[model samples]
Target: MLASGLQQPAHGMEAEENPYLEIVKRNAFDLTNTPTNTQQKAPEPLKANDIKLTGIYLRNGVERAAIALIEKDKKNTKPTYLQLAVGEKQGTVEI
Candidate 1:
């Protein structure tokens, strides 16, 4: 009510226009225009001949068990490790 004792418009809430709706509505897409099956590059394969097991340490009463691996590549050599508790082994590495 505009300073008058008159009944308000239907519950006093009217549908308001959203300004951004026009922009988004114009950019709406359909399945026909949608892209699918994007090209994905395959990862470089790891060769088993290049991986070497350096050492295996079995756990003692208080000591931890660990397996050390060395991967030799043309760029650089890297060391990988797996640590385990007594009677535990990690999933086997193929290489």
Candidate 2:
């Protein structure tokens, strides 16, 4: 009779010793249905403190001001400017 080198493992012992067995169970999630947000909320309105007066200029009898709108959460970035005439109105502030 020929001698066999390998021995059969116990029924539940093979599953307990396997490392990749848990991978299948971990990835058993819903693949077809996914949750997502379709509606986006409106951005917050700028306040009075967020605006700054950078400079003022006078040319030919007309006066204008350079108004700077500071960006949120940025310190080193340049602010956006609006050139407005003496009596021009932007939002709630008058130049």
Candidate 3:
């Protein structure tokens, strides 16, 4: 899956035969150079309104596992920014 994400436009070349070369060619610019514009841009900070609960259904076994992982992270000291809402009904939780 990671390989497919990094795969390059082969332009008809066989990917299986030379996957490494394909990755190198595709990421050459990103690997070798930095952006010419040096002006740094500050990322826009999230506002209070941006934090909200997102609902997702536990459809099957795989989805159940995914939800478990998300829920586990939510228990950490500095939890991830994502808010996971499970089950058939919708609800909200205060931070």
Candidate 4:
């Protein structure tokens, strides 16, 4: 003869009861302190026509990346000192 499955010990374990399920609350934290970030614009290469390299000198053994430059907008009269580095929109450019 065929035998049936066991249904005698089905209610053996107990279920857990949460106490704070009725009084749940949340708060919106202030985010004004967080700094806003923006993507940097691609830097355009220094136009050869607009800028003229005045001089390049080595200072001792240290890095001498600082070069004298003058933009055409100023009639090339004022020499604006600049460094030979990548110029980014977010970064300060020496003048």
TM-score of every candidate: 0.26, 0.39, 0.17, 0.26
Alpha carbon lDDT of residue 79, candidate 1? Answer: 62
Off by over 4 Å in 1: 1-61, 72-75, 93-95
User: Candidate 2 lDDT, tens digit per residue, 47-95?
Assistant: 5446888888987788889888876677578877788998899776687
Measured on C-alpha atoms, candidate 2 has an lDDT of 0.75
Backbone clashes, each candidate:
0, 0, 0, 0
Winner by lDDT between candidate 4 and candidate 3: 4
Q: How large an RMSD does model 1 have?
A: 14.7
Q: For candidate 3, write residues 1-95 as lDDT tens digits.
A: 57957867665557557657777778856764666788989989643232323444465442321221124334454433443333432233322
Over all chains combined, what TM-score does candidate 3 have? 0.17
lDDT at position 43, candidate 1: 89
> Compared with the true structure, what per-residue lDDT tens digits does model 4 show for residues 1-95?
44477434333242124334333323244345556776778999766424445555565653334555555567648666665533422123433
Better model by TM-score: candidate 1 vs candidate 4: 1
The number of the candidate with the highest lDDT is 2
Model 2 per-residue lDDT at 63: 89
Off by over 4 Å in 3: 1-18, 28-32, 41-95
Runs in model 4 with CA error above 4 Å?
1-49, 83-95
Ordered list by lDDT, greatest first? 2, 1, 4, 3
**Alpha-carbon deviation at 66 in model 1, angstroms:** 2.8
Ranking 2 against 3 by TM-score, winner: 2
Q: How accurate is candidate 1 locally (lDDT)?
A: 0.54
